[model samples]
Target: MTDQPTTESKGQDGPAVVADGLTKVYDGFVAVDHLDLTIERGEVFGIVGPNGAGKTTTILMLLGLTEPTDGSARVLGMDPARDSLRIKSRVGYLPDEVGFYDDLSARANLRYAAELNRVPKAEIDSRMDQLLESVGLSGTADKRVSEFSRGMRQRLGVAEALIKNPEVLILDEPTVNIDPEGVRELLDLVQRLRSESGITVVLASHLLHQVEQVCDRLGIFVSGRMAAVGTVAELAAGIEKGHTFEVEVAARAIDAVTLMELVPGVRSATLDGERIVVTADRDVRPEIVELLADNGLGLLGLSTSTVDLDSIYHTYFTGAVNHDNVNA
Candidate 1:
């Protein structure tokens, strides 16, 4: 901790991050290829791919932990190659496996991190307290890290990352082995960070459903290349009849199949069980509701139904790894 490097950086803004034609190679093996990405300030961006898809390599290149074989990136308008320290000062990273001193208490571990980051002496204790409470770990403040649960350690890892108040947070598989409740708590904390502090977050994970839960936009990676990038609906729109919606009525509206087809963007409509599923080019819930009402059909329910993410992944996750192009 005593030999830790200190960094001071001035604030600058454009996008929180931007990468153009970024590439990485190792021992003649291509780990990442021609990557182009832009993450706006205060946006939650998810980089989604399976293991061996080069998501971690891409993240490392962006963070300057690994050098790119070609192209470049700007994090907070600073080149990671030349200004990594400055960028690091303004960014926080939480890897899938977080390590802490087993013999130390939770508070002690965080204090060490605060010192390593050169947090102001006067502000360190207060910040640590606030963070512990926010992460739901106040009760475990004095508990030895060795005694903590995996979820507890993850919560503390988040607090440790934020001790310096970084503008950008990069989380690599933030939720992995935790329980369902722990996963929910962590995801909710991410939401609160965006809504309350307007922090920019970059989440890299293979969990499709979790990524869909919180990201504003997604980058689909496959075989060391980005196959596509956009919102769930936008990505879905690129597929034939990818976007869909569901509607239910008080009675059997036999005309629903006919009415939905008349709506713009609708490719096909069919009745399935108690619901009418409408496959469309975009969200047509408003038009669908109006259409139902016009035909004297009482609207019992209406919702934008997302395509199964596994199917979406199978469709886009290809060896060719080419995508010109989701509502989740």
Candidate 2:
């Protein structure tokens, strides 16, 4: 492996992307509001939210396509707003809706894009060939882009982003047009990029399941602002730690709650017909089994339920945007 210089050994120079109080306003309407984010090198960071949540707008600013109304942002130590050309050379972007010249062959389309990016003429052909093969488009290299399927086009778009082998990759809804199988392939490629090159990746998507699989850290956006930023486990532990569980016992619902109250770790217990749910600090499986076994209460089934990603998003957003007013 080539010994590439990393941001870590450089200390304060560790962050690959930084946004300090970033904001975008349009005709008195705020799109992105005082957002602060940091993305470290060699990490896959994910941003998630619903439609019109300023996810696309945020990415535009990061790519030097949208102007920030307040504060500032930098990619690879250069201001994207002011040093667009410099930043563009160091970062690769894949938009949510990828478009291409329909009449041109895959090879021809990539050749045109490569020239625009100013890739060396001598290396362009070989690089394009490698990228096409990497994305499973080698067989369709001579085929016109118009004949390609939506999934194929998406794969080509990914190849286009990697043409220059950028150090930082920014993708917006990369899995939108991809099939389930294609989604898996695309995700695997993304993981390979980070592992092989240690490239800092910024992925924006609504697929929380996919995000949870790849991201080392995540930022949840709501109403143009970041509502929460942390790892999956950290967020769960902090917000959902005190959640209550429901318990039910066959024909003796009241007895189940009464028996659960005797357990040392169980904070509270509630009963429903034919089943019981218990909420406790730690995993209640062992205690529940012991309690049922010792009390001679026939335990038919036991399950644990906790807050999921959607639940977490709602909890923060419902409070962040109350009665159509955004809170500071």
Candidate 3:
């Protein structure tokens, strides 16, 4: 790790990625509008939204693949535009579509990547061995990439990104078009990488479940702008006035719904047959339970629900947004 940009020598002291008022415009349309973001070291940060929500454009700016029309971004404490070469050495990137030589065996392709990243000759073999098993590809290492499934290829792409032993990793739409099991495997691998290596990761995707499954924090993008950024609970707290809970009573508590509305923290309550849906600024389950017990009603069940990622997206983009207007 000496003089190399491995996770060890990088010195995790400050934010790994930062963007201040970062804006990108394609002709007359805006792709990213004054975006401000901060990703801490050793955290898996997910950027999520629907397609054409400016996620790719933001990633391009951060990678220095495309210039931002306004503002600036920094990766690993260096300006991406001017220090792109140095930053690229420290940051591993995986695009939505990973390409590999169909004729090359998985092991052979990894060897090429290791060499390209300038891994020490003595370290390359051991590193490859470790990575293959880590990504669940050791059994198929000698097989040609053409024989690998879509999941296998993505796993290989992850191994390729780690060949450099990068301090930071950025994945764009990593789980798109993959089966459910494949998505789960890929996301699990992401969590393992962070826990084992403490590498800072930036993941860009439109899949809500995938992001929530692994990321420590999430940034919700909407029509070239960020609608919210935080943990799922924090974002949910800020999105609507509060949280929601679904409660069920053994008896039909239709009037209980109206009574629940008067609870200290409850905003409103509605009855769905025997189920009661209560919206509140804070948790009022205790008071509700007390009320039921006082009335000799039995509590059957209780559940908490947050403002889902899809609903959060809709809150910002209520109507049709023509992001195609921006060509970036």
Candidate 4:
């Protein structure tokens, strides 16, 4: 993976969200510990961790629904503790389990949300239509929410969150219990929201693939502390582990052991049938091609794999990676 600047090193006028040494404790248990995070405007930032990793607590604190035991946080340049109502006016949040009046139609639910947000009654109908259509619920706008599937309801929740046309959207496990197709639709909607409306998004989830699919950058939380923060490529490069490349050769003339010795960056190479798996400090596909060509060997296929988020998450949470050494 190519190296890129870490989010911490990037210069900006001000972040969309900032948490300084954010800490939360309850009944002698530390829920969140000295967590510092910066989310830029118009970017999708993901907070990923397993259940009970303090993801929900962090969200609650940011929304001013729960006070921190120590430290401070700001959303859109306003203190959540002191300016929660003002912040709520500019931010939209969808919880892990979205609730609506079951008997109400999708349109009615959105109208209700608009009313609660104090949206002008004159514009509520247009706003509801726009939101419902945007989230792909126009056809089901009159359908009772109770008859909607989990995925449909999740999409409706997104529309409800957008009724006030907020600048920032905070979603807690938006895809939980959703079908695969529903998940795709929701992620696409999120991507469109940022691209079309330039709305800053904060998505918190335990699912790696979903987060990886949507976030511009990620903050990995483990045991109530941020373990790492960066893009997928940046995170992979930060780890000490080398990458692996697999090459399939058509000719039998080349030996895996011989190739391993000749390659400059290869750490190890082993042949499995027609395929050779090589571990290298960096991408060595070009070097392998050169070696095979020089040895009169024909390459059938070549592919590279890096340290994925799953491995990185496991390493940090299991103490394989020292917590103190992590830059985040």
Candidate 5:
């Protein structure tokens, strides 16, 4: 409700990606609308939303896969739509579903990509070797992609995407088709690339916990628009505080109501079940504990929780998005 400027910090490398009034429309349907986002260099940036929340559309624009309807976007200081070839050379991309030749071996597939990108013949062997190892597909380099399992195929997809050792990585649900173990491997590889190569990552997924774990910042899209964008803690701080504290006394403690009423900021008090949940505008745990001590009431337990990304997603889309809620 307040008109406060965002105070989030982005380290000195500058924004890796920038968008201003970017919009994408298909006929009369709008897929993205006036989205303004800035992703810092060397940071893991995640885009999370429902099935049709424009997450992919936004990525497409950033990767130069789709032209925007209005506004502009710059990826690593180049206009992605106009400088696509220039952009692609410095970027790695893994689509939601990766397709490969059934007859070709993994080595063949990677060599073909490397050649297309004009990697030198002398460098291709070493490049392919390193990429395959990074994705844990070194042993299967000679295996035909079609004969590979779903997990194996996914790993090959990741290796292929990195053939050029791009500076920015665009991944669309890289962990979606894989098992838990595979997911961990992929995430670890992504972190390594960012740490060792100083690459910036743009990840799109419906998995909030994964975003929370890997991303330095995130944006939530709802019904074709950005609902919230910031670091996890910044998003948590955006919710308004209604009151300073709420405390419910145990029914067995009769003087609970009288004692709480004497406190300065105690506007309301009630008795709940065996436990009490309070809504506080400001943290009042210290004050509450002292008051409870003086009143001789046994405070059984106290805990604090915050409104998570799932709640923020729903607040913007209402019942429009049907996705599993992840633990915040």
Candidate 6:
């Protein structure tokens, strides 16, 4: 490891991870542009983008495996570049493609990792058994990795990352190539780790649904820049286009078109059979209910046709959103 200058501590109460203008340039081609991000302790933060959008590069920088050309990153209150070994001791990383000795049993593979992490010999057996059970691999602990399925291997990879009892776990495209059941298990395991152990998680993936399922907050990356960062609802509100809600109402004195004009935030309302579809800047469900009551309409059903991650991605990449609205 190359020597680097030490940085002042940001204190223990600060975020678990902090990237300040973190950039990486390979032969003048920018892989990751100036990026600023933070992940609070015990938060399941997701970094999402299309292929080559710099998600992996950013993760590498955070792990101190790849040195940044410009800017800096800190993990667990230590500079990644200068305190990499210390950071690695407390941080666990599972790459998209995790490798293990094919001939080695799952238990053996974890034993190897434990040795590398300098886990005490006395504690190795107990830790390995606990990790295997935590990752749902205790039954296959003695099975050769060569015979393990993709899902099984992925679970073992997670177990390997946990051998050191890391405070923060970083998974890169962990759900890729795994079966749906495996994906669910992995996500559940991640959530359990956070809830039970207070481990901060940083998940990087192009898979929107996986991120949506496990992450507390999400950062959308476009062309090596963080386009937006927030919860699902916050991102939806940042866009100019409003969410659409479908309402089924019985006979009413006021029609859908007239109701649109009467509501304060409703931008458009169209009648489709017995259902009324209303689009608005924000959730107008309460206003909608009041309007129905005032108009003497009987409400049968009400549902918000939510704005999903796909729509948010499309809007941001296609330039539908005014850049000023982006959280940066």
| Best prediction by TM-score | 2
TM-score, per-candidate, Cα-based: 0.76, 0.79, 0.76, 0.78, 0.76, 0.78
lDDT of 5 by residue, 1-328 (tens): 0121121222234577899899999998999999888887778998887778898888889888899999999987889878988888878888887789889999999999999889999999988988888788889889888889877887788788778767678888777767888788778887877766667889988777665678888787777777777777765555433342435554464466566655666555554554444444456677778888876777766556446766555544564322233212
TM-score of 4: 0.78
For model 5, what is the C-alpha lDDT against the true structure? 0.75
After superposition, candidate 3 runs with Cα above 4 Å error: 1-9, 242-306, 316-328
* Local distance difference test, candidate 2: 0.79
Question: lDDT for each of the candidates?
Answer: 0.83, 0.79, 0.83, 0.84, 0.75, 0.83
Which 10 consecutive positions of candidate 5 have the poorest summed lDDT? 1-10
| Per-residue lDDT value at 117 in model 5 | 85
Candidate 4 residue lDDT tens string, 136-208: 8899999999999999999999988888788789999998999999999999999988777777899999997
Q: Give the poorly placed runs of model 1, Cα more than 4 Å off.
A: 1-11, 241-306, 319-322, 325-328
State the lDDT at 184 in candidate 5. 80
Give a tens-digit lDDT track for model 1, residues 137-220.
998899999999988889899998888888888988888888888889999999988777778889998887887889999888
**What local lDDT does model 3 show for residue 94?**
88
RMSD of each: 7.5, 5.6, 6.6, 7.5, 8.6, 7.0
Worst 10 residues of 1 by lDDT: 1-10
Error of 5 at 186 (Å): 0.8
Q: Write the per-residue lDDT of candidate 3 for residues 66-165, one digit (tens) a residue.
A: 9989999989889989998788888888888888988999999999989988889999999999889989999999999999998889999999988888
Answer with 5 or 6, whichever has the higher lDDT: 6
